[model samples]
Target: MADFTSRRTLVLRRFARNRFAVASLILLVLLFVGCYTLPAVLPYSYEDLDFTALLQPPSARHWLGTNALGQDLLAQILRGMQKSMLIGVCVAVISTGIAATVGSVSGYFGGWRDRVLMWLVDLLLVVPSFILIAIVTPRTKDSANIVMLVLLLAGFGWMVSSRMVRGMTMSLREREFIRAARYMGVSSRRIIVGHVVPNVASILIIDAALNVASAILAETGLSFLGFGIQPPDVSLGTLIANGTQSATTFPWVFLFPAGCWC
Candidate 1:
């Protein structure tokens, strides 16, 4: 207990000492709260349209203003944010989880398993993910389904990290602790989960965080291309796509969601 307490204290001290990380964490928390909570308290719904107030700028009644459709921009932005945040977090977790699992297994098992997995990774890495998504999204057309979007983003995002994880696992699997576990006849699953995965976890943690940003950008790009999160539903990408025409005249429509998305 004492040892664990000291470790926890040490970690907290280290984290707190990192001014940038501390600031980033605080800002992230605030942004999340604003995205998820503020919309509920606001009087406007994204769908609620007021034809009389079409293209109105920010006002007391419509805080962020109204779109050409007269729908509340604030509500739309909040809704888009809700979806964007969900997609980012889900894709990051799914992709990183897959990379860690596949890489660990391929590396630890070696031979045929390693060859097959590496071959698959090389194939995927060679192909352009954006082009693949563009071609596939039309057939699937599950843009409205958040789960489908998450799966699609995760499928494209894991290959590079999986290769990295594989290298890390290859190095770690031959270490003394791993050799001891193998000699003690610990199950491959247990050793991989308990030993190999944890050693590479710091890399995975940072990778996952970066992947969150990547996932958001990917989703936004797809949506902007008229592929992701379909109409009446807004993602940051879809919001930007919808507002492009008005960018010159009604810059607020284009900028509001884009700003929140960034």
Candidate 2:
């Protein structure tokens, strides 16, 4: 209990000292809240467009002004944030989970399993991730299809996490506590879940946050290129792409979405 309390206190103190992490956390929370509330409360749907109001400047009625299609820019931006964040989170979770699990098991077990998994990881690392995503996306156009694409992105992206976790597991598996647990007949699953996972969770969390940012950027790139989230679904990338032609004349078109991304 004392040890647990000490660790908890340490975490709190570390978080307190880490201003960037705290700020990022706050931003993350605000983004999530915006994603949930903005779409529901918005004056118009993302697809609702009025050509008559095209390219209007920001005003009380149209908060961020109207796009070429005269859709409410603020509403589209809010909805786009939702979609971008959703994709980012999904990719991060799926990728990290797969990587962590495979890495932990391989590192703990060793032998042929480790060799084979590491080989696969190396193979994935050698290939171009964006190319793979482009190739896989057109196979379907449903939400499930987009989700599958995200998963595929995650799967290919896990090599870094796998290597990191494997190294940590190598050191951890040799520790006195691990040996003691083993001698006490703790099952492998218990040792991994109750001990290893908890110990490595902090690193995993940091990596996951970084990975989320990367995934969002990746999705944005794909969408900008006309391959990511489809129409009726306005991602930041798609919004930027839509506004690219008139960037000089209507800078708000790209500026608004890009601001949200930053």
Candidate 3:
């Protein structure tokens, strides 16, 4: 417990010393708070149409201006941000969990387990995930299908991370602690959970962060192409795609959402 505490403290200290990471974290936190909280106080909802304010630039009455349909840009941007953030976070966590479980199990118990898991990973690695997702996501038009979108994103995203975890676990399984746990008659599950997984957590943490960005971009791309999030639902990609037509005349529509997405 003491060792774990010291390790955690050291990690926190290291994180704090990194100015970019700290700033990024602060900005992310603020964005999250703003996206969720500011919407209630805003005069317009994403769905509200204001025919009078169509294509209007940023102004006091319509803070981020109105889109072609007269929908408030700020309201839509915040709503889009909320959806994008949720999808990104959910996909990252689910994918990382799947990777860690499959990789650790495969590495700790070799032979058939390793062969099957690695074979699955290789198969997925070769499959065109983007094409598959694009083909399937459009079919799911209901608002409830957002969960399906998240699952699909996570399903196709874990292969590379699983391979990395498998390699790390292969080395970790042979370490003294792992060997000692085995000799003491600890269950394979406990040894993997308590000993092996914790050791490789650093890599998993990094992978999850990268996955968040990857998932968000993947979603944005799909949404831009009109296959993701669907109509009546807002996302940064959809906003950007919608904004592109009038980009020359009404730059605010594109810029505000694009900036929020970035």
Candidate 4:
């Protein structure tokens, strides 16, 4: 526990030392708070339609404007942001957990295990993940599409991270401490959990941060292609897709959502 606290403090200090990282973290926290809270305070909900305001431009009443369907653009974008953040955070954590576990296990117990895991990793690396997700996502029930999409994105997202973990674990396993733990009769699982995983955590932290954006973009692309969050449930991708038709005439339809995405 003491060691863990020290490590965490060190990490916090390291992160705080970077201006861009601090700014990004603040912005992310604000985004999360705003996305979840502001909607409740706003008069318009994403589902609330105002036929009178159809394709309206930004005004005091409707900050971002209204879509062709008469839905409030600000509400829709905030709702979409909530969904995207959920998916991005979930995919990043799950995928990174999967990668760390798989890589640590494979590297710690080399030979056939390593070979098989590496082979699987290589296989997934080559497969057309986006196409497969696109084909399968449409078939999922609307209620569970977001959940299914997160699973699919995570399923294919961990291969590279796992491979990186494997390499790191391989090097760590031969270190003096690892052998000392083995000689002291510590179980393989405990050693991996307590030592291996922690040592590789720096990389995992970086990967997870990167994965958040990657997952969000993946969800956006899939949704834009019409395979992501289904109707009645708005996502940034869906908003962009819906707005694409009126992009030239009603640039707010496209620009607001796209800008939020960026």
Judged by TM-score, which candidate is best? 4
Q: Rank order by lDDT, top first?
A: 4, 3, 1, 2
Q: Estimated TM-score per prediction?
A: 0.87, 0.89, 0.89, 0.91
lDDT of 1 at 209: 73
TM-score of 1: 0.87
What are the RMSDs of all candidates, in order? Answer: 3.2, 2.8, 2.6, 2.1
Runs in model 1 deviating more than 4 A are 1-29, 138-144
Which residue pairs in candidate 4 collide? none
Tens digit per residue, CA lDDT, model 4, 1-262: 9977876776666666767656765776788789999999999999999999988999999999998888899999999999998899899999999999999999999999999999999999999999998988873336576678889999999999999999999999999999999999999999998789877776787778778889999998888887788677889998999989999999999999999898
**What ranges in model 4 sit over 4 Å off?**
1-26, 139-141
**Candidate 2 deviant stretches above 4 angstroms:** 1-19, 139-141
Clashing pairs in 3: none
The global C-alpha lDDT for each of the candidates, from Candidate 1 onward, is 0.83, 0.82, 0.87, 0.88
Residue 45 of model 1, lDDT score: 85
lDDT of 3 by residue, 144-224 (tens): 788889999999999999888899899999899889989999999988887777777766766777788899999988999
TM-score of 2: 0.89
